[model samples]
Target: MSTADDTQKTKDPEYLSTLERGLRVLNAFDADHPELPLSEVATITGLSPAVARRCLHTLLELGYVGKNGRRFILKPKVLEFGSAYLHSMNLEQVATPYLQKLRDQTGDSSSLAVLSGDEILYLVHVSTERKIRLGASVGTRFPVHATSLGRALMAYQPDSVIDAYLDTVELRKFTEHTITAKAELEKRLRKIRQQGHDSAQDELDYGIVSVAVPIFDTNRQVVASVNCSTSTTRVSREKLIEERLPLLQDAAIEIELALKKWPFLANSLRG
Candidate 1:
């Protein structure tokens, strides 16, 4: 059974089904399905038409969602949740300047991401003005096995945790260079752990190269990963490792220091 199916089977009695349905309705909207009709929302959330209608109406009344003729779409107010979390963690504030500096130094895109389930969620992104093959914005998510940021974060995890992830998650191949073999990916992750950084070329997308280093918190635990990404047409993988990887590692160290000084921020992150 899938994770969603497992979650459904383990439903708690105290869980508020109404609120859960509402959040599911909201989550049904994404980059691919940005605007959805009422029926589509019901289908995605596995809720009846009446329940989905109630949730949509509640969200609309609360300014979390908007209606365009017959379809419903998320409003800017929904960003309040993400912004509040970012502010509470001080992630954007602490990581933005360093990411910007890395971008400036490498003339490439720099990003900070945290492992979310089997994917990496981009929390902060600073992009160069020049068009790049791999365009990452804040809130973008990428497969953990196919990106340098994902490898960097996964490299430091406990062996059992990594083994469980490898056992449970399906490795989807996105390109010719994507790692689909579990043993091969495990070996690569081991190398990343040994090297203190990870480099990827044409894994997630063609003509894109990236290098990432894990960022540690005050307790010396890997908290997040920072990466520098550029077009392979402009920068070779060797060049990315020799030049951009050092800049990315330096920024990770700076971010780790900031996290140590801001103990409250670190606590909030743990929470």
Candidate 2:
């Protein structure tokens, strides 16, 4: 039984504090911190140790998490959350064939990603037979300030959202080419909007280059971005711009057309 004070603290009578705390505990685990002790989970989620322990136990019973001696880790069942969203959105299903076609045409890695928080979340990736180290895979996230996919997605966002993002985000420099200045990034985003595409050269990783174009919904709203990533050692920036950019744009257009045909997909488009 929850007390009136507890319910009042949540500010909404319908808000379930236990459920929110449990979800927060789950979110505390990520690629970097995949496993953590109960104390660490409590600290990371800003919950008391007792509260965190209860949440962990509930998640464990639900098969969403597993315990290894003193450490707790996310179980395979946790993927159901992400998979459910993917299935509901149908973005991965719709983008897969187009991404594969882009990969076949460019002989490089092609990916479809959407803006998640302040990062680009890879939803689908089609890799070429040739080994390329772009460090991108489905579920991978990279800062929106440092990737062509991010720029392409951000370019189509409303000016207020873009301005708010640039004003608050701490632009970390991943490489010498990474833009750390908000004004410069704003200018670059504007250019991407004007050109209908964006490019990143050794900004996220050394010797890696990528070009991306925005996918639009039936209402011409930007939904997602499609990108082709290649090793700079194997391809010049000029060559990638001249060749792969067009292919990426075509894939984006194809994805948009496919989304228009599916009412569910058109409704799922962000903004």
Candidate 3:
């Protein structure tokens, strides 16, 4: 198999080596191993403990990692790395204005979310004036089984991917309305695929209804999804479909247009 070095040959060797190792160290930590001692980190990344300590110390100095006793763990400040990518994506930047427009039109909270692993990670969010709206934020993570964004993305993924996700991740019940049965979840995903959208009612959090549509890449593959959420007290299912669905669909199309202009996405399209 071709390695990262074979694929990427850059002129700046020093900068490349530093950036590569730093990312490897960050990749060494995840949900299963949220914290690690220097020796463990070295083992995970195949680095010397002394070298690992230096990298961890550098991350600690930058406020990205914190020393919990003798162990190193990621800090909330590590979100800066994700934020940097989100900020650079002009699609997300331009979509913010359009999302705000959707909020103004429907008086509902709207968000841009992407499927990450088995979860939906919110990237951009806009809130409405309603006091009882959905309380999710830009960096919040929600379960794939219970969120509208997750359903929309799943509707477009290969059946094997969806099956693998359901087989691997535990379907913890978040609310009485949440679907825990894998068979039911598969049934719902089929409906979502047929409709090209999803409406999740209080499955994630009580009193919140989330509606989502898939955002497509230039090849018409699902790249991400956009959602509008409102409290059950504020909007009925019929009203949401009648009023907000059009706006969400329009915003998603605009986001697709904006996505095409991004250098990374453009290159991906070419390749």
Instruction: Give me the candidate number with maximum lDDT.
Output: 1
Q: Which has the higher lDDT value, candidate number 1 or candidate number 2?
A: 1
- Prediction 2 global C-alpha lDDT: 0.87
Query: Per-residue CA lDDT of candidate 2, range 54-81, in tens?
Result: 9999999999999999999999998898
Cα lDDT tens digits for candidate 3, 1-271: 4457545655446456666677789889986899999999999998878878888899889988998899999999978877676766664565788899888888889998778888888878898767663477777788888898888988888888887888888888988999999989999999988888999888987888878999887778787889889888888877887788988999988878887777475343222
TM-score of each: 0.90, 0.91, 0.76
Give the lowest summed-lDDT range of ten residues in model 3. 262-271
Model 3 scores a C-alpha lDDT of 0.82
Clashing pairs in 2: none
Query: All candidates' lDDT scores?
Result: 0.88, 0.87, 0.82
Off by over 4 Å in 1: 1-14, 267-271
Ranking by lDDT: 1, 2, 3
Which candidate's TM-score is highest?
2
Candidate scoring better on TM-score of 1 and 3:
1
Off by over 4 Å in 3: 1-55, 61-63, 67-79, 131-134, 266-271
